[model samples]
Target: MNLTLSLAINGGTGTTKKRKQLLRDSIVVDDVMSCDGGDHHSRVVRLLQARERMMAKLEADDPRVAAAAPDDGSGGLRLMHLLLSSVAAAESGDAHAAAAALHEVWRRASFRGGDPAQRVAAYFADALASSRLVVRSSSSSPAAASAAPPTRAERFLAYTMFYQASPIYQLAHFTANQAIVEAFESGGRRRLHVVDFDVSYGFQWPSLIQSLSHAAAASTSRSNSHDDGDGDCAEPVSLRITGLGTSPDELRQTEARLARFASGCPNLRFQFEGIVDDGPDSGCIKVDDDATVVVNLVFPAAAQSSMTSSTREEECSALLARIRSLNPSLVFLVEKDGSGSGGNAKSRGRSSSVLPAFTASLRYFAAVFDSLHECLPADSAERLAIERNHLGTEICDAMASFADYNDNYGGGDDDHVAEPTATSWKQMMERAGLERVELSSRTVSQAKLLLKMKSGGCGGVGFRVIMEGEGGRAMSLGWRDRAQLITTTGWRSRRRSINKAFC
Candidate 1:
């Protein structure tokens, strides 16, 4: 099973000249400029010129609010006028107005585009229509977007902070939640006890809740409405969640979420147990022969293990040994893909190469220079440039970094840490006395489905496996492949019950 993952780099860091060139070449050209000396040409020129003007304004950090003073109804009207004015200037052979209008459009479009090329086109199309061009949206193709939700990098200033906020960290949460749901389904358990090794922000739990609610609701509704209680009937069960974390504050936050969830469903219980900050030593949880689902949502990787005292190898081994001894319905394990940051620069330290280091602070500026050099089709470049300016540096940096990770375009080093693969995770579970069951995985991509887990190892459901406990009585289940769960939820047999549980 292949686990789709993403990476988060420190924001605003400078990309190398080499990286910039690669980014330009990587974009496939879609169309050519068909500018003429008429209204079409004028409009096109106006747009390009507006883009250039906007770029300059943004470069100067102008706060004029959408070229001069922006009014209250600026939502789409102002943008339209701005765009039309540029088009008119360009096509009318007025190079000056055309240039000014193009610049303005370019500056404002970036912010309005929302970091997707499709959105950028939509923004421009709308702007054109506002300008009385009456352009249609079906004229352009779709652009790529980041699979992972966007966030600021300033939060990751420290190594600990950086490690906690990494995209892979969220992937780990996905792995755990996936395991829990699969285990409950196979074990026929009505409840689950999830021992989260580290609960930083509880990012993965929400996804699980959404997916479980969605899948169970859809399945139950469909089955009840369509299935005639024949052999195709799928049973639904409730999930009792218990999360463990070292920070009391975080645990309290998790507890609050449980409280909110409990208001609607009485059967489903969610609890956050705060444990002492020590190495991995099962504080209150014990692996026992009961109808309970026990899991360790911790990473023992050399890279991430250092982030927590309990996540060390020996500690993890002990914890796993105990888990195996208890014989859980299943065990889900996730760690850093490989080791090391893979970037030339170490956390809170110097870079491997002096050139990148010297130019690091100017990454955004360098990107600007590169964009100028690329000289996109007069229309395209203008559109792209204007959009970039409006989005602001912070948002642009986040999007650019996401794009780099999504396409694997930047960073001096190529040695990225591989998260647990299906085979490796399966081996680990088996070695620890757990048997493999069902498996599922999906790649996160805007180009394809953002996220979907295929069933059965390589492609099954949304995770790698849904193992039943071994020993005939209650088989210990696990994923044959090492996968990071991105979503979690419980299966309910009844549609009404599911609606009550989630609604």
Candidate 2:
């Protein structure tokens, strides 16, 4: 197995690379400054700040941080109205009106408060600000050089906080694992190799290790009751994970963490290898003829963080193509939800895509922000950290289209967010000669059970899970009345036909 990870940021052209400094400097602006929010000076500062965070890979602040401020019942409706007005003003090139709207949003919105809608508005404000503050001055300060990339500790902290606060990571990992486990069980294989495309903190593997260990223990126990001493019926299972990541130190730490956790799983033999994502290309991943191979495509953060990213489809498509070459037993395609024939459109974004994509995410993240109110209290520091340090950066980057990024992308139809006529990921997977595999009953049941355990936090029934697509192979988990936020689907390589002449 071979991999590279440290998810987020631009999906570049061919491969999904780590987000890097392009986002680090852009969105991490000082929420309050001496400069007037409506002035040209303010616009420069906002643009420069957004641009800097764009390079720095930062995000908007947390709404929970501002929960102390009076909401005045203005969170949901007013924020949406302000964002719509801001979009209209920016699109119409009414600089003054846009500035006023932005100013009002800044005044009313809390980047560090507990209102999800208010936080969504803050990010959209950054988006609107980035849209207007495009012309970065050549006289930009020497101090504007990019801050050092986030340390491994910082990235790990962000990944852990989000994983603990939300069911997003758990949903992606457990569902995918179930599919892989079923594939192995049905195929009658004992060795499993999982190549995780984006394995940041290695959070997905511990549960998988435990699951496999339990099955092995149960299998061995049954065999021991019948075999006596006549045969060695040890249901030995070997599991290997090839994780792709951005840095050596983080990868080493993840390897250590996973190894330590796996050590406690007595019946499972586990091996893990962490490789840098950008080191090599096509033939780098070495496969085993004996092991059942699986590809795990869950991104590093968020429910749909990578799903709504601008370049996600092209990058993911290219990735699927590479994985097709490996001909794995199962490919778990996990992403944020979409409405369609299904199994399509892994991306919908603001910058480098279309306006509708931005609007779609604005609505989606608003719900996400609101849902947090149920999951975390207003004053919890973890809530603030998750929003500001992790999700805020992701939301801010969603709207970031650098001044020249459009020049390179050409705004092709393929970049459309969730448009009706968009090219579907289902089509992409099919074109790669991979067939969509149904999510097994066990997978769907486990998904529902997960939500049931966490339902108290987000309110019951609203976060229900349902099987989607024909025969219910696709599973979706979402908040009430809105889009299914995260969907996990399984796929397999189509078995080639035997030659008639040979037969």
Candidate 3:
């Protein structure tokens, strides 16, 4: 069955265009340095020193280190120290030293349960091979590119590997699921449609499908109780998901994954269709009048820039306007919490310089690495692989963005742009004629609980729900109160009066 949806693009003229604003360098740089009380250079130095200390502790017969097994917390700490040392060395231009550090990391990390050990070993091997090539090349000649652009399989591997090491995906999925549940319950609509923007691997929908099934069963049970002595259950919910992506293969993969998930959910009837598109424009989205629609934007807005534009305002505004026309019951937006030059209004006019963007990226990834250090074990090959493919590559890409030979290091023409901040997204949503709906207090509590469960009883990570720009709301995930990631939710107001209040 063919199920495609579209939204009309409004072409009304005379709409006032607002002047673009850029984030101040001082504010952006200071925000990144605040957590470590120093600049990015100093922070890197400190991390290296800490790595040395950790190495010394590992060499010593410290009771904790001795008692710790390869897969334990201490082992994870050791692995993290080695990984950070390698990164520091590579960043400092000691490619051979970085190779050595990676070797040690691979040797020390455990590979007992899964193929992570093999994957991490392969990554280290590749690094060592690249280092050898760099050493063999003429000092005066530019070095050749060591690797090709990532294939689709490699990209998918990197994406999944990143999810294993960090809580960002988990946090995003949790937030989105809460929003979905709230919308599903409150609207009381028997049919629900979910539009996932840039759906990669369809990882966010399985749990949501489960929740919908449970809710459907509960509602049916209640309806049966209220019926005239009838034992029959109420009608099942009809769920249709529309996944948008640029690649037909990736979209089909997402469909397959979701189809499998739906098969397990017998409480509701499910349908899924994948759409290949560059952006959300006319004839790309369809809304059913009898169904409540929820739009899910998870880390999709950051890469919306084109070659001619660094600011995502125009793209974001157009997309939001189209979505608003559909009158979605809820819009779930999740983005990284930094001001880099790529994604939204905050990054406008600053795409030429790389230092500000690099600093922000450094600070953000540092918190992530620190969190991983606290949560995973040194012997966990999965953690090592994740760092190598995900976090490690991110740090390298940020540095390469500023280099004169950036193209040699897999840097594209658009690599210098800054990322978006939560505040910028709030403004963009408001401009698109959407108002923030305060997430329930229960949702906030659930987020806290989810973090606690993921932290492995360390209590190192925390979050706070803050209100911004009228009724707009944002939840920040941080380490020791330093914000790392922000997930925000927006809703279309049914009453015109409610919309005017935000204006």
Candidate 4:
């Protein structure tokens, strides 16, 4: 089975040349980073620092691994799903298949159980560890046989979490919740299912719960106050949210966090479900009966990474096609910003066995942090300090440690962090037939600046503060809590009118 799956990935041809070409064609390295011989020493250093900080935080915060954690992480089904899927996939002898299975495992897993993300992370780490130690023959040189694989697990975990940062989630959820509440108040009754992709830490959806609860309460309050003996009143709003993740622990954590949120807002009711071990499916996002499902999965373009080869394009296409078929009110997608240079597309003069994209991203982020520390003002040093306090200093250090791992493995330096933009996701959503409605950005450069100030003990302000004084809020102040790359035709008018009045 391993041989078969490997063939499936490498193509049936036994020639190394064929495999290399196939990898190059499927995994567009240029999409990851564009190297221009510029001075990246500073950037690389910052990344190392951030990697260290993040790792320390993880070690301190994870419940299973740590003696005590900051939060309970009760609703982490997404994490569980990933773990189950990875184990299943490994057992089944098809790595990709195992990864794919995580979607369903996440969806169906209990909302209050083990964490899927951590498990899957561990699984990948363990797998890589095994791969690194697997010596096929004594004839191989000691260095060749004993070399370690890249820190693929760490990179994957960090990138996945960073892809859907807390702020982005807050922004996106803010917008969608507003729209959803307005729809509900306008005599709209719909069953909403919210499926989050790569719900690694489950940090994104708590704000979503808050938004829904607030919206529901406002609608109820207005209804009670404005009614003048009108028997023909609009129906009360109802919302059912089904959240999907790759881990059971994530699902469970989500449920717990949301439950606390729901307790504060009685008008809104929600049922959160988890699907274990599956990726986003087209069938899941179909909107029926005013059902507006929002998918906030942050993944590198499949075309850019070996983890998601060209064959998986069908999966991406199918998922989008299903969402389009549902014709929901809105769909938002977000992706990491890449350097505009196109060199990432060019194949290196090396072997085809590249480390997974997530692993590469981890190194890249670590580099960003290290770079920021060196370049930013000393005032922003508090950002690193606070991060160290909350997360740890190991965040950046992990990357440096892993750099050796990458060098020892087939992984090369294909890491870079560009200003954040939504271009790639915009294209994908457009192809999926979703219309454009809104776009928001928070670039890595800008984030670095903010973190700099934060490090300086300025307490860090929102992005809008630069223009709106010390009290500036987000441009879309009350929109979704998650940042979004949205495309929806004919709906622009509605948003424009709403913003004009609200602003």
Best candidate, TM-score-wise?
A: 2
- For each candidate, what is the lDDT? 0.35, 0.59, 0.53, 0.35
Instruction: Report the candidate with higher TM-score, 1 versus 2.
Output: 2
Candidate 3 C-alpha lDDT tens digits along 205-318: 888889888988888888887888846778888889988787888888888888888988877999898887665542356667788788888876443232223335566666
Which digits, one per residue and each the tens of the lDDT, describe model 2 over residues 1-503?
Answer: 00000113433431112122211211222222224535534444443333333222211122221222233534344444445444433433345545665666666676665556666677567555654332222232121223243455665687687787777678888888888888878867789989887787888888889999999999999989989688998868999998888778878988999999999998899999887887236226766777888888874222233233445455656676667766788888777542211123334334323334444455456656666666777787777767666666665465554222334543434322233234356777788788887777778788888888877765556566757779887777666544466677888888642221100
Worst 10 residues of 3 by lDDT: 14-23
TM-score of 1: 0.37
Q: Candidate 1, which segments miss by more than 4 Å at Cα?
A: 1-176, 210-238, 262-267, 286-290, 296-303, 306-313, 339-430, 435-438, 441-448, 451-503
Across residues 1-503, which tens digit of lDDT does each residue of candidate 4 receive? 00000001212223333223323432322122223435443333334333333333222222222221113332222232233233323322344534343333333332122332332233233333234211122232222235343353444444343333323333333444444444334444545655554454555565556666666667667777888876444443345555555667666866776667666766556666555545543123333445544454433233222221223345557566544544445444433311111012211122212222232332223223322233333354333332222222222233233233334543333343222122233345556555554222332234334334433322133211111112321122111111111211112111211111000
What is the model-wide C-alpha lDDT for candidate 1? Answer: 0.35
For model 1, residues 75-135, the per-residue Cα lDDT tens digits are 2223333443433343333445434444444444443332232233234433332232222
What is the model-wide C-alpha lDDT for candidate 2? 0.59
Instruction: Give the Å shift of residue 32 in candidate 2.
Output: 25
Off by over 4 Å in 2: 1-75, 84-98, 127-155, 228-230, 233-235, 279-283, 300-314, 338-353, 401-404, 410-423, 496-503
